[model samples]
Target: LNSPESIAVVVAKPIYWLSVALKPIVSFLGISTEFLLKLLGVTVKEEAPVTESEINKMLTEGVAMGAYEEEEPILVENIFHLADMNAGDIMTPRTQLKWIDLNGTEDEIMEVLKNANHYRIPVGTDSLDELKGLVTVS
Candidate 1:
């Protein structure tokens, strides 16, 4: 193992490994520095939108750094989850809904409002299936 070729191989192994480990970081710095230099003193540059995964990552880091409460990330993540869901996932089914009937008596509408416990009650012609509009009870 003392031969010239053997010594070269031994030294090359560590150098090769070091280059492989640093390649990504070096490439990223090279590209990012170039981009920053181009954007120096520039304003209103169009940027890529922050993605849901990126938001989650940021929230996790913020929580770890004590910048955000533990519950904040859960709330933000739930909002993202909601964006992935259909209306049916959160909507109350017709059978369980309390709606206002246009032809119903005023007292009946008031009764529905009192029992509904919701700010906006659906308005329908005869039943929940025929939704005409919404009655907002403030």
Candidate 2:
């Protein structure tokens, strides 16, 4: 257990468990740092690393960390290639959708907007089977 692999396994266990248990809480609070710490059974300690002395103290104490340096940037050939991934692979889909009949009168369209709080509404011919252009009510 003293090897690098063992150390990685030990260190990764808590982080993985923390991420799994905190996912719902993180989603509930919209991924805010303050919320994340609370969800992770930790406290948010704020210490400014503004001054040279403060920065040096942070580095020495391992309080603040530096970003990882990568030799090459990540490249994506087709974003749809990511479709093989499931919901957990990406952020939550928070889309607000409203459907309207394209042949409907202006008043009908306005009525839909008045009832629902949305900026854009997708126009459909008959049912949602046929989709037309989008309408902006704002």
User: Each candidate's lDDT (Cα)?
Assistant: 0.89, 0.66
The superposed Cα distance between candidate 1 and the true structure at residue 115, in angstroms, equals 1.1
Candidate 2 per-residue lDDT, tens place, 1-138, comes to 459988897789899999999999978777676677788999767886576455445444442234322311122213334756887555433343566887889898778888866676778997766987777886
lDDT, model 1, position 93 = 79
TM-score of 2: 0.30
lDDT per residue for candidate 1 within 39-104, as digits (tens), equals 895445689999988999999999999999999999998888898999998888778888899999
RMSDs, each prediction?
23.4, 17.7
Per-candidate TM-scores read 0.43, 0.30
Regions more than 4 Å wrong, model 1:
1-55, 60-75, 81-89
Pairs clashing within candidate 2: none
- Residue 82, model 1: lDDT of 91
Model 1 residue pairs with clashes: none
